[model samples]
Structure formats: structure tokens, C-alpha cells
Target chain A: MQLSTRNQLKGTIKEIKKGPVSTEVIIDVSAPAEVVASITTGSADSMGLKVGEDVTALVKASSVMIMK
Target chain B: MQLSTRNQLKGTIKEIKKGPVSTEVIIDVSAPAEVVASITTGSADSMGLKVGEDVTALVKASSVMIMK
Candidate 1:
């Protein structure tokens, strides 16, 4: 799908933490670099995200913050 | 600074959009893959973020969600 956001990292799922309302997904983007994303529990389940699976973490530029 | 977040992408500043209170920073993570992050104007100014500067996009897994 064409995403409006510019950053799209190729990653592999490394961990999944399911919460009552939200789910935490850890993705191994590159060695020693991982991406963690919190999404709704229902969305996680529906997506069937599991460890070792390839997925894309979509972040709108609006949701990203810059730090020095 | 060491962050608790897991996703950190090494990139170069590509664009900057400043608003009244917030700023939009876009980074080129890889070829054709860019990441957009929204940060406060104060923070952006304090950090002295500018184009062509090297940066790391830190994303908390909790702030990340999964997609198919």
C-alpha cells in the first residue's frame, strides 16, 4: 500500500506483547536496531502478528518526534 | 543520550516544517525510505535541528503498531 508517511523500514518481528487494550510489537529492523510499536489489541490479533514474521511499521511524520 | 525506546533509525535530515508550537522533521532512512517525526518547536530549536544533519529516529515500541 502507498503510505503517506515517508519512513518505511524493512524489519522482522522479534517479539509481541499483548495487552488488554493495546499490543506492543518489537521489530528487528537491522542488527541491534529495533522498532517498537503500540497498536490496539484487536488490530494486533486481526493482523496475526507473530515473531519471525516480516512486517512494516508505519509511522506518520506527525507521530514521530526528533531528539538531539 | 541513551533512550529506553527500541527503534532508532540512522538518517539524515531532509526537510523541516515549523509550526506555531510543533515542528515536522523528515529524515531519509534509506534510499527512497524516509521517516517523518513531529517534535515541539522548543525542542527542535533547542536541538538546533537543520537540514543535512545526522540524526536518529527513536520510536518506542508502545508507540508502534503492527500492520499486515
Candidate 2:
């Protein structure tokens, strides 16, 4: 499926921190650089995410903020 | 102030599309890489944002998504 979100970074699953309702996935997009994404536990379970898996990190433009 | 958001990309304001309630801010973070942000018009007006101004695009970990 196609996404309208502009920022899509290629990464691999570095770590997964599972919570009761949410899960935090730490991705290694670039060396020494990690991006963290918090998704619902349901989504995580549905995706069957595992460590060392290749994935894409997506952030909607509306969810982004500009710091001046 | 310090932010907990993990992704902070530096860029210049490339374009601004203003609407009644929300405004879209396009940032050129790197060559050929642009990140878009939608912020409230009130915040936009308060910030006095304009094109060519340097800014940072921030996305909270919760706002990010993982796609496999």
C-alpha cells in the first residue's frame, strides 16, 4: 500500500520494548543513529515484528513540528 | 528547552501553505529531501515563520509508525 506521509526512512529493528497497550520499536536507520516509534500493541502483534527485521519508519507531515 | 522527540532534522523553510485553521510548512532538510509539517495557524502566526528561515523538524516517537 502507498502512504501519503513524506518522511519514510529505511531501517532495521534494533529493539522492541513491549508494553501493556503500546510497543516501542527502535530502528537503526543510519550507523549510530536510531529512530524510535511507538505503535499500538495490537499493531505490533499483528505485524509480528521481530528483531533484525527490515522495516520502514513513517511519520505524517501533520504530526511533525517545526522548531525555530 | 529540551525535547524528548528523537527525530530532529535541521532545515530551512521552503514554503508555507496557510489555511483557516492549520498551515503547512515545507522544510528542506537536505538536498532533495523535504519534510513537511502541519501546525496550527495560531502557532504559525505566533512564531512569525517565513520562508528561508532556519528551523528544525521534530517528530515524537509516538507519532512515528513502522511499516514492514
Candidate 3:
């Protein structure tokens, strides 16, 4: 499927921290750097996410904030 | 305010495309690379954002998606 969000960073799943309703997935986007994404646990299960899997972190432009 | 979100990139505003309800903000984070952010025009005005202003783009962890 195609997404309209322009910010797409390719990475590998480095860790999955599970909670009751929320899950935090850490992605190794660059060496020594990581992107932490918090998604619904149900969504995580539905995606069948696992560590060492290749994935992309998608961020919508609308959801971003400009801090001055 | 202290934000739990971990992703924050500093950049300078390159352009602001205004729309009736929404506005698109382009930031030059790195040389020749830009990050596009869309926000409500009301919020944009309240923040008093302008072109060439130094700002930081804030992305919440929950708003991020893990795509495989």
C-alpha cells in the first residue's frame, strides 16, 4: 500500500517494549542512532512485528510540531 | 514544556505554504535536505513562525508508525 506521509525512514527493528495497550518499537535507522516509535499493542501484533525485521518509520507532516 | 517524544531535529524554516485551514512548513535540517511539516494555519499564526527562523521539528513517538 502507498502512504501519503512524506517522512519515511528505513530501519531495522532493534527492540520491542510491550505494555498492556501500547508498545514501543525501537528502530535502528542509523548506526549508533535509533528511532523510538510507540504504537498500539494490537497494531504491533497485527503487523507481526519482530526484532531484526526491516521496517520503516512513518511520520505524517501534520503531526509534526515546529518549535521556535 | 518537557516532551516525552525523543525525536527532535533542529533546522531553519525554508518556506511556508499557507492554505485556508492548514499550512505546510518546510525546514532545511541538513544541507540540501528538508523536512516537510503540515500544521493548522491558526497554530502557525499563533506561533508567529516565519521563513528563515531557527526551529526544531518535534515528533511524538505515538504519532510515529512502524511499517514493515
Candidate 4:
């Protein structure tokens, strides 16, 4: 589970929920609420996450690249 | 994206770094530094992420479940 990438941020597993096939995990970050809002609008689930659970949401490194 | 699990978090892509095969994305959340630390310990890359990139890190809903 030792990731080797460089980009690292700090957050908490604010919530955790279960679904028919998969489980959901949420992290509360320290960035702008709006930014998180936008990401959530297209990246979050529907069953509603839990209130407390430590987890990390990993995005594939290649999926995102520098714009400028 | 359009992830539909349950747990939703709020954070910013603080950094983005490139790797030999994939890119690295870093998100800054609003949770405990320690929690994020542990997760990052086993969840981040090594190529060094960017400084300002809005992204959403999605974890499989089933990967996380309710403890109680």
C-alpha cells in the first residue's frame, strides 16, 4: 500500500457508507469549499457517507496532467 | 467523472507531478493531518504533484464500509 507518487495532501475520512456492490468513502479537506463542491458534484456518491472514517481517495496519476 | 457511491469529500488538487507511466494528483482536505498522513503513507505517488489543480480522487465504494 506504499504509494510512490509525489503529490500528497492531508485530509480525513469524514464518512463511510455501503452500496449494493461497493462501499463509499469521504474525506474532508482543508481547501476551498467551492473546489471540493465542484469535485463532489461529479465525483461523489449518493448513499451518503459516514461521519468518521480515515481513508484516502486515490486518483490515477495519468488521468490528470498539467494544463500550463 | 460522475462517481456515484455515497461518501463525498471536499479538497483541492494542491499538486500534480508526472511519472514514467502515470501522473500524480494531490488533494488537500480539511481533516486531521494525521489521518491524511496515514492514508498518504500508503496511498500517494512519488513523482511530486503540481501546486494548483482541481481534481477529485475517487475510491471504490466497496473498498470502504461501515465499521459500526
Give the Cα error of residue A42 in candidate 1, in Å.
3.1
Query: What's the best-to-worst order under DockQ?
Result: 2, 3, 1, 4
- Candidate scoring better on TM-score of 2 and 4: 2
Model 3 agreement with the true structure over A1-68: per-residue lDDT tens digits: 54444334433344434445433344433322234556665666566555545555556655665554
Per-model root-mean-square deviation over C-alphas:
18.1, 18.9, 19.1, 15.2
In model 4, which runs have C-alpha deviations exceeding 4 angstroms? A1-68, B31-68
lDDT of 1 at B20: 50
Instruction: Return the TM-score for candidate 2, rounded to 2 decimals.
Output: 0.46
* Candidate that scores best on lDDT: 2
The docking quality of candidate 3, as DockQ, is 0.13
Chain A TM-scores, candidates in order: 0.50, 0.48, 0.46, 0.34
Cα lDDT of model 4 by residue, B1-68, tens digit: 55433233334445434444433333445543211112231122332322333333433222322211
For model 1, give the RMSD to the true fold. Answer: 18.1
Q: Report fnat in order of the candidates.
A: 0.23, 0.28, 0.27, 0.02
Residue pairs clashing in model 2 are none
Model 3 chain A: worst 10 consecutive residues (lDDT sum): A24-33
Error of 1 at B66 (Å): 1.7
Candidate 4 or 3, higher DockQ: 3
- lDDT, model 2: 0.50
List runs of model 3 lying over 4 Å from the truth. A1-33, B1-34
Candidate 3 local lDDT, B5-34, one digit each (tens): 443443334443444543334343332223
What would the per-residue lDDT of candidate 4 be over residues A14-60, giving only the tens digit for each residue? 54344444333344445432111122311233323233323344333
The C-alpha interface RMSD of every prediction is: 17.1, 18.1, 18.2, 14.9
